[model samples]
Target: MKNRTKELLREGKRVLGTWGMLGDPTTIELAGIAGLDFVLVDMEHTARDLPTIEHMARAADVVGLTLMVRVPDNDPKTILRVLETGVQGIVVPQLETGEDAARAVAAMRYPLNGDRGVCSITRASRYGALRPKFAEYVESADRELLLVGLIETAAGVENIDDILAAGVEVAFIGRRDLSGSLGVHGAAEHPMVLEAQERVLKAVAAHGRAWAGLVPYRKPGEEEWITHDVPFAVYRNDISLLLEAYQNGVRMLGRESASAHGQGGQR
Candidate 1:
């Protein structure tokens, strides 16, 4: 199976994604079939546990959608356990320095790269079914595992260079958190927030690493981020989409009913 997320980035293409915060495999499968390049399993703000994550991963795999998890934090055990669920990548939030980035990468690697306690018999290794050739599997995983560092604060933006040097494949700017960090809470498009984001994007590109971020779902004429070389984008979330669809339908129905009532009275 191809790591569609990284593959698109490597090709200099924008990869579209959606957030799977509902802990439902059905939503994940729907996203995959809808042609999303990837789904971000949001463990950070959700109640999803190991079983739920594994199910989501399986659904993503079956439909050819690349799955990545935003781990709760940089905790070693949490990182290792999530990776073992066979997700192709991890998004480590709150990356404030080079050391933070390094620590996250270490949790994803073996002793030579970092101290990740090894267990050949896990979902990541196909439960040891690929043994003997396990060395190759490990090497392939090392090369393919994407490390996405979330730059959510002013300090993280300032330390972008160090974060990049510490082996992050992609630097994702968390606009909401960053706006708060800039003291313009919720104003992701505030001048100060945009400037800080620009700085981080520039630094990430200068170091030959990729950058990712969120954009409002189909915000009119908002293609500048891609033009600026952000390859990964989370367009929206399942819950938001669901709510929007229902609300729009209700509004349309109300308008139709009012129009019918007015027309009948006139007749």
Candidate 2:
């Protein structure tokens, strides 16, 4: 399948996406319906398993959304298992060195480009139906698959240059873990955290790579958070979105009902 997210990046367009933490295909489908570029199924901090990821991929396919997954770690076997489910890419978390980045990339592709296990019967190749020529599929998958190296640890920031130079298409500045790592502890807007993020993004831009992170919808300074140089951006996650919407709706209705009763409007 054509990875529309990669195509958008190639066109120098902003690729907005969200996390599918609920492990529900409907969230993946909703992300597409909501005009997102992709759905990053969060296996790193959620209960989303391989089968759930595969179902999300199927839902993404139906809606023409690019499906990517965040693996729990930098393990090749974990990445390989995620790729076999037909995801467009792998977001390997806790990158600390160039070798970590390269190893993650190698696990996403086949020989020459990398050493991914061969299996045409997997959903990634459409179970051998869509990709009739195995060789052609291998080449295309290698070229089209996206590899994002997550920079959360202090060591990752120190080795930013080498990490990006290791062929990471996108360097994600995970400010939550980053802040915690920096002893800021959830203070994403702290000066130290902000500086670290800037350093990482600057490194990515210098290496001719892209930077990624989550941006709140319609928040003040949102525009400042996104830039032409960084094409990969996520807009919150499925669980949070649902929580916000439902909470707002309930609060609004509850306030209105309370006001009506206070005004003695009820029969």
Candidate 3:
């Protein structure tokens, strides 16, 4: 399958995706069919566990979507377990320092450079059966897999420079949690939050790395749209988008009903 996320990032286009907190395999398959660049299987906030995540990853792969899992923390065991499920990428949350980011990279790579245990029969290795020219497959897997470090806390912001220097390919800003950490909870539009975002963009840009973030609004402001020089943008989650569309439709129908009743009375 093509790694659409990596392709978009390389082409410098804005890759769009949604959060998959609802760990249902059918929901993931539906999102893939909807033509999203990727879907983040949120393990941190959702009730999803390893087995369910593995199934969801395979479902996404079947539909040509790049599956990325947001690991709960920078735990090596969690990283190894998810990667073995054949996910294209891993997003490590609460990354605060260069060392933390490096550790994530280590967990993704094999030993001699990292501590990941070798397993030739895992789904990532195509169940240990070679398709002729197996070495090529291993090389491609190493090159295609991504390591994304999520910067969400005040301390993470303080150490942003070091994190980028650690060679993480993508630095994603967790806007909701970031705002709270900056003492401006739910104020993503606050000047403080905006400035923090700017700093993050600058640091990542300085190192020639990719960046991504979430935008609350459907129609983003000019700065929000451009800031971070964001190559990939995760616009919203499935549940939130569904709720918003449903509420809007209901409100519009009510307005139309009131207008029609008034016109009838006048006639």
The CA lDDT at 5 in model 1 is 80
Clashes of each: 0, 1, 0
**CA lDDT of each prediction against the hidden true structure:** 0.84, 0.82, 0.79
Candidate 2 error regions (>4 Å)? 130-132, 209-229, 255-267
Q: How many steric clashes does model 1 contain?
A: 0
Best by TM-score: 1
For candidate 3, the C-alpha RMSD (Å) to the true structure equals 6.4
- Badly placed stretches (over 4 Å) of model 3 are 131-135, 216-229, 249-267
Provide the lDDT at 16 for model 3: 74
| Candidate 2 TM-score over all chains jointly | 0.89
The candidate that achieves the highest lDDT relative to the unseen native structure: 1
TM-score for each model: 0.90, 0.89, 0.85
Q: Compose the digit string of candidate 2's lDDT tens values, residues 1-267.
A: 578999988887888888777977988888899899888788888888889888888899999999999888888899899999989988889999999888988898899889899888888888878556888888889988999888888899999898888888888888889989999897878899778888887777677655555443343556544442567888777776776676578587864433345743321
Compared with the true structure, the alpha-carbon lDDT of candidate 2 equals 0.82
Per-residue lDDT over 1-267 for candidate 1, one digit per residue giving the tens place of the 0 to 100 score: 258788878888888888788988999899989999898889999899999999899998899999999999999999999989999999899999999999998998876887777888999889989888877887778878888889999999999999989998888888889999989998877899889988987897788765656554323477643335478778778987876676578687764433345643211
Clashing pairs in 3: none
